[model samples]
Target chain A: MKIGIMSFAHLHAEAYIQNLRAIPDVELLGIADDDAARGEHFAQAFNARYFDSYAALLSAKPDAVLVCCENSKHRALVEMAADARVNVLCEKPLATTLTDARAIIEACERARVKLMTAFPMRFSTPLVEVKARLDANEFGRVYAFNATNQGEAPLQQRAWFVNKDLAGGGAVMDHTVHLADVLRWYLQSEVVEVYAQTNRILYAKEIQDTRVETGGLLMLTFANGVFATIDCSWSKPPYYPTWGGLTFEMIGERGVVLVDAFKQNLTLYRHDLKRAAWNSWASDANQAMVEDFVAAIRDDRPPRVTGYDGLRALEITLAAYESAERGEPVRL
Target chain B: MRVGIVGAGSMGVVHAASWQQTPATLAGFFAESSHDATRLAEKYNARVYKNYAALLNDVDVVDICAPTHLHHDFVLQAAAARKHIICEKPLARTMAQGRAMLDACRNANVKLLVAHVVRFFPQYALAKQNVANGSIGTPAVVRLARESARPKRPPNNWFFDFEKSGGMLLDLMIHDFDYARWLAGEVETVFAQSIATENPDAPLDFGLAILKHKNGALSHITGAWAFPPPNFRTAIEIAGDAGLIEWKSADTAPLEFFLHERAGDFPDVGLPSSPLREDPYTTQLQEFYDALLNDTPTRVTAEDGLAALQIALAAIESARLGKPISLAEARA
Candidate 1:
């Protein structure tokens, strides 16, 4: 399968290229970027072609196009790919608005093309094992969970990431979709309502900076009676030195299961830190997600993270934005 | 190597037991001028000091396990008498007092170590090892929580006085704060919120602090002395670019050490039953003694204690003023 990339702009674009290159079943098709310089850089680095325009890449009609564009651009890219009858693996936050998201889904359906939201977190081995354990009542009755999403303040890196119009919302929109989607996937339930608050206490940028807060706190109630919270932010200072990953605690009726997907440790203890290391799921989460996305393309299968799932998570992010803006809970 | 413990409370007992079987001598015990010194003296097989001056002048190393309010005076006196010192945490109520204690020890050329025992905990030590070995990559996010159910009857009434112990931030949360600072580094800024319920008539027992280091790693710490039962739960999750590492005291059952790393295959990193004894206090005392005897450095230095205390105080000040507090602001 020749998997060409649509943008080098999305943060995970490099990972997409590297993973695609690593898989034997896939070939690296030329990449397209709005900026010719970036496209040329990737082309030279990866030994692929460079296109200055999205239309030119579509005309080449690669087997699949990885839509690594911003949320606002997802809709147009998906529509263009569907019209070209090209399959798509869209980066998360499927769309900026519900209308555009719904339209993309309809276009993909009408064109009979495979459309997948690249939510590779679902493919994480530890998370999948956690899901299995939760399903088998390994940890017991599901109670509450605490999830955190922290990264470098985006505003410190680029001005557009903090711009509400270009990026959607700040940290909440940027991060919660992934966490929310993972929560939904793990719980196998819908998010019924959300009460969230956001502010720009860290990044002093003025553009759609609603999402570029020093920190964000959220309370979510899933339909399956599982309660979860997401403390999201780009508030980590430079000196502390860390990257982004997921660490969470799940309380059940039988026992509590603490799983860190990024860390790939699923430890079950009798009750304290002094015990032995339990069975830990050690598969590479990101690689697993990427492999699944590629397999879906090759086998005519739907992705582990469907476009609908991404839309739902995107809805929650948007709802959180509305709630923060209106100072009220936004019901899903 | 005779050791004189200046408090006969629970921690004092822990300390006394740690020193008794070791090479160090259990010189005697002392109580606040008001407490029942004679009763405690009888239980511990030691003499009672009616006068702290007599105790300070008598013992080779004066361990200040006294309440926070008494820490400053006792340490100063021990230093004046040229006694080696190991004082309990929050070295003093205020940074100024802490500095004074440091100055006194320096002037007297006495070996002074502060008991930041968390670093010596086998589990945290292992967690530190993983981070140092690039197991988690460069840690981007650190979420640490230390929560305990409020004591049914807090020992000293002075614990409620803000001027005495520096409130919960110093008295209880300082453990997590110190550990976070040690694991992370110098915190450049802090934004915090706290609650002191009038019904309890106590200092702030529950709160959250967001700390930023100069290196860009963000730390979220939620500490409470107001849980429902006598539970000591502490968990740390560090997310790095390559992987994740976490520790939860409660997840390691039957044992007291809780350290978990992302492993492809299980490696037996089991901890031996206490290094010198089952008590960490003994290990601490042994380390201090070895450092002095061998002309090495103490594991938990006075400077480490001071940095931890400074971060704790910064969190408190942030909570007090309802804003993000900076270390620069703290120094000013």
Candidate 2:
């Protein structure tokens, strides 16, 4: 399978590149970014060719392209890919607005091409096992979910993340969609209502231009009667071990299942580094996600995480933003 | 000082044990159930009063650890008897009741101390002290989580009744609400989401509340009553311009600090080497007794309790209305 990357705006693009390279049968064609310097820098560092424009990369005839542009730029890139009749595996959130999200899905559907959202958590080993247990009725009917997806401010890696226009919103847009997709997948339910609150508290002093919210908490009620809370915040401090973490507790009729996606880590206190760090030895979820995407293309089938799945998750996230803005719960 | 405890359940027993470590004498206790009152009195080597009024006549201090719905009546009767009062949190189920309780205490010239015990926990106390000292610069954000097993009470337990206990938001999460207000000042607005199992056969509740503080800080508060027994955990994070401070009950390490580069010269932050042997409940009771004896101010005043209750009630209202409630609007 031949794959190209569309933009390097998101830091995850670096990890996805490694994931693509590790697959024995996969070919990494090259990378493209509007910013010439950033595109060339990574292209050279990874020993790959650089395309100055997204269109130039699409012209290379890759089987699929990974969209890693800023959230607000996703719709344009995905539409461009749809026009080229290329398969796509866009990053999480799909797009900033529901209109843009729907447009991306519609374009892909019209072209009869596969469009997948990059939800690596679906491939996380522990979470996968938990889901299997739920499917097997190991915990009985799930009653509720308490989840958290937290990370450090993205300003350290990409300043555009804190910019409202570039990133859509803040932590709500960045983190909520991941868990939203996971819960929907796990319970096979659709969120019917959303209530959210957000604030520009975590990075108020660190960044000035962004009017986005850095902290957010969302409450979602599903059609199946299960309710969940998602604490999506950029509250992690810079010097902490890793950038952030994901954890959840799922309550059910028979028992409760707890999962920490990044728990398989060794805490290191190194004098040379002058700071503590968490060295993760966990199975690479990104690698699994990339493999799944490649297999879906090879089999001429839709990816396990499809664009509609992305649309659904994006809907919940966007509703959360609307709820925050209107100060009320939004019905799906 | 003679302390008469109202209610002979878990909180009453806890208060009884803590008072034993103080200078106050355990005069007696009143309970709706004679069996519970007798059992508790036997264990504490105290008397069992047949009625609340009789208990009030026998002691100088009335410690109201009864069901939340009864707090208003207990407080009013105690105030009428001119006794110093120590009430368990939520002060009352409604703001009107809380106001009346506060007013009655004030008019009688008796100290009213509400048990917001998180303020007395050594770990929490140290964090508050550091914040007050401006160790982390100007506080900007706060997050708190308290999780515990669903209370397995008899069918007749009032806690299972939302109307009487105010559900999980007012009963359990009010601790974090009080702590957040104590750290970040008054809340300007609140939005929340919550779920209580409608099926009486499966009893559990979870709540998440977001408070936008008047000081430009924001607080994310989460409480869960879905875990199994012997599985209580609490975690807190406070972020400011200069750095962050974090603590978790499940982690072996003490409170951790990650100061910004500009704060490199600040003193090393460390938790107390030896954990304080005193129970926080005992410490809080001691503080309350000392204030009364020394004619000093109580650590958690009636006004503080009232304010925290107001926020909790507002959060409940927000959850009910499916909208955020401004504190100003709620007050009006």
Candidate 3:
């Protein structure tokens, strides 16, 4: 399988590139980014070719491409990859808008190429075990879910993250989609309505330009009567543990299940770093996601996480924004 | 100070024990069932009043630990008797009731202290102090979770009645709601989702409320009554520009701090590790007693209790209406 990365915008791209290189049967074709400096830097660092233009990378005829462009730029790159008939594993929040997401999916369908949305939480080992238990009906009827996906502000790593136009929105856009996709998959239910509250409080003094929200809480009601609360916020401090964490409590009739996706970590208090940091020694969810995407193309099968799945999650995330704006729930 | 307690249930027992530790005399207590009142009074070496009014007449301060639905009447009676008041959380079930209670206390010119014991918890109190001291910079976001087993109530207990207890949002989550409002400012809007497995044979309840603070802060408040007995856990995370403050009951370590400064000892600042010999309940009662003796204002005022109640009620309404409720609309 030949896999090329579209852009080096999202920080996840760095880890993903490593995962791609580690796969035995996979050939990492090259990297492409409109930002020539970033593209060239990563390419040189990884010992891979750098394509100045996305089209030039597609000309190499890679079997699949990982879309790591800005949130707002996902649609264009996915459409381009689809036009070239290359399967794509797009980063979370498929696109900034439902229209763009639909266009991306439609383009892929028209070109007869597979489109998978990156949702690595579904591949996290602990969450995988939880999903397995849920599948076995060990929890009976799930009553509610309290989940959180939190991270530090990405301003230091990706300045575009706080830029609404480039990143789509702040914490809500960046974090909500991951858990939204996971909940939908785990419960096998569609969200019927969404209500959200958001704020730009975290970086009010430091951030003067962006209109994005740094903290947000989304309430979702699923069709199956299960309700969930997702706390998606860029509220972690820079010197804290690892970048972020994902955790949840699932309440059911028979029993309750608590899961911390990033709990397999060792905490080290570093005097030089001047902070206690969580070093995660858990299985690489990103590696599993990359392998799944590659195996789907190699096996001539649909990726476990599809473009439509992305669409549904994106719809919830977009509705959350709308709900926050209107100060009311938005029904799907 | 002579103290009288209403409702000889678990909370009443807790209040009685705490009051015993204070300089106040446990004059008497009243309950719907004389059996419970007598049992609790005997344990505390106090007398059991025949009725609420009798207890009110005998005491200088009225401590209402009654069911939530009875709070309004108790407050009105205590205020009419011109006694200082200390009431357990969720001041009243409805907004009108809460407002009337607040007005009555104000009109009677007596100190009205609501038992929002969470504010007295060392972990939470330290977090608030740190925020006030600008240790974490200006607070931007807060995530709070309180999980406990279903309350062990006798048959026909008011807690099981939605109208009486206001379900988990009022009965269980009101603590987080009050603490959130205390940490952040006034709530501008609330969006909530809840689930209740109300079957007598299989009881479970969960609630999540998102409060968008008027000051641009955001809070995610979660409460659960689905865990099995002897299991109660709470976790809180506050994030701001300079750093983050986190505390979890499941963690063996003290409250964790992660500041952005990178050239000092790990954690930068440390919280006291020694546990307080006094319980939060006792601390709260002692504070109330001191305020009464000094003729100073109580830490948590009637107005603050009213504000917390308003948020809780709005969250409940939002969950029922399947929408977010604006504080302005709630006031109107």
Candidate 4:
């Protein structure tokens, strides 16, 4: 299977490039970016071809492509890929607006190309195991979820995360999508209402220009009468060992399960780094998500994480922002 | 000073043990249900008071460990008797009850300390002190969680009643609510979601709350009565602009605080303890004694207890109404 990557804007692209190369039969054909220097730098560093433009990459006619541009810039690149009849796996928060999200989904459906959202948590090993138990009636009925998706401010890796026009919003847009997607998948329910609170006190001075929220707490009510909270904040400080992690407690009538999706690690107190560091030894969810994307294309089926899933999660995100602004619960 | 311990249940014994070590003498025990009242009174070399009024009259201070519905009467009577007070957490079952108790204490000119013992836990205590001392810079975001097995209550135990104990939100998570306010000023609003409390037959209860502090900080709190026996855990993570502090009650973490264990012999009675051999409960009550003796302020004031109750009650209301309750509206 051959695939190309569009843009090097999202830092996840670097890891995705590594994952593609790790697959036995997968070919990372090239990387394309409007930022020529960035495109060329990653292409050379990872030993792949460099395409100067999205049109050029699409014209190359790889079987599929991954979009890793800014959150708002996803639409144009994805549409162009679909127009070229290329299956696409778009980075999370699939688009900044509901209109854009809808348009992106419609573009893929119109062109008869597969569209998957890059939600790796759906493939998380620990989450998958508990989900299997949840399906087998081992827990009877799930009652509520207490979850968190926290990380350091991404200014060092990708500065665009703090830019409102490019990123859509702050922590709510950046971190809410992953767990929102996971909860909807595990519970197989639609969120009916959202109430959220956010604060900018943590990183206002660090980010300098944007007053976008650095800390956010979101409460979601599902159609199944299940409710959950998402601490979707980029509030990790500089000394944190790793980027951060995703964790949740799922409560059921019979039992409860607590999951830390990223807890498999070896901790070392290293003198060189002058801090305790965590070296992860866990299975990579990004790799699993990509493999699933590849299998869906081979089997000619929709991916496990579809564009509709992305749209639904984005709906919740938008509703959360409205809820926070209006100081009330916003119904979906 | 003489400290009369009320209610001879698990917490009653726990308090009796702690007060024995304090400078104050243990006055006696009083309980309608004498599961361990007689043994405990003997163990402390104290007599058993036949009634609440007799206990109040005999002791200079009253430490009430009764169920939620009994707290209002116990504290009011204790205050009326001109005794200093140390009441078990939740302070009262409802906002109005809490307010009335605070008012009574003020009118009687008596000192009342709510046993929010989490404040005295070394980890949390240090976290609050560090945040105040600029160790983590200005507090930006806080995550707190406390989950313990459903107490093996008698069939009619008020812990399971939403009106009497407020389920897990008022009885369990209120500890974190008070701690959150202590770490990051007063809260401005509360938004929450809960599960299973509405279903009387459900085996477990869970609650998640988001507190927006007046200082522009956000705190995400999770509390549950869902684990099986002997399975309980708590976690805390506070992120500020300069640094972050995180701890969890697990084998791998530095802290080994095993609170509220229904220990051997008294399979249904609690002996909340820390591996550090430090009893936060004792520390809490000792400070209460200091406040009464020195005529100074204690760590948890009656107003602080009232403020925490306001947040918990607001959380319960928000969970039921599916809306965010501003502190102004919650106050009203």
Candidate No. with top DockQ: 4
Clash pairs, candidate 3, are: none
The interface root-mean-square deviation of each model, in the order shown, is 9.7, 2.6, 1.5, 1.3
Q: Scoring each candidate complex against the real one, what DockQ results?
A: 0.03, 0.35, 0.58, 0.74
Per-residue lDDT of model 2, residues B1-332, tens digit only: 99999998778888998999999999999998889889988988899998888998899999999999999999999999999999998799999999999999999998889999889988899999999998987677688988876676767778878899998899889999999999999899888877777655555677878788888787888887766554567888898767788888878445545545563332211112225589888899999999878987766788999999999999899888877789988788
What C-alpha lDDT, on a 0 to 100 scale, does residue B314 get in candidate 1? 84
Give Cα distance to truth, residue B65, candidate 3, Å.
2.3
Predicted candidate 1 versus true structure: per-residue lDDT over A1-332, tens digit per residue: 87789987786888788888888978877899886887888788878889778899989878888998777888988898899998888987898899988998999889988888888778776777788877786754565666777666665445666766777777887788888998988787898877565555454433344435545666576777565667776655433323445667664444345566656445555455455443545665557677777788778888777789888998898887886566445678
Cα RMSD (angstroms) for every candidate in the order listed: 11.1, 6.9, 6.4, 2.7
Model 3 agreement with the true structure over B22-115: per-residue lDDT tens digits: 8899998899889989998888889899877778778999889988988999899889999988888888888889888888888889878899
lDDT of 4 by residue, A184-244 (tens): 9999999998888888877788676565788889989899988888999887766788898
User: True interface contacts reproduced by each model, as a fraction?
Assistant: 0.00, 0.42, 0.83, 0.87
lDDT string, candidate 2, A154-270, tens digits: 889899988889898888988998999999999998999998877776677777765688877777889998878888988788888999899987887765677999999999999
C-alpha root-mean-square deviation, candidate 4: 2.7
Index of the highest-TM-score prediction: 4
Taking the tens digit of each residue's C-alpha lDDT, what string does model 1 give over B1-332? 77888887656777887787578778888887436556666766777887888888678888888888789999988888988898988788889989899999999999778988777777777888887887766655677877664444445556677888777778777887787777777888776655555444331256667676776666777666654343467778765544556666666556564456455322111112333435666777788777766758866789888888888888788667645567876777
Residue-by-residue lDDT tens digits, candidate 3, A187-297: 999999888878787777666556888888888889999989898988887766788889888889875788889989898888898877888899999999999999888
lDDT of 4 by residue, B207-306 (tens): 8888889888899998877776665678888988888888877643555545776554234522234566648877877888888899877778888888
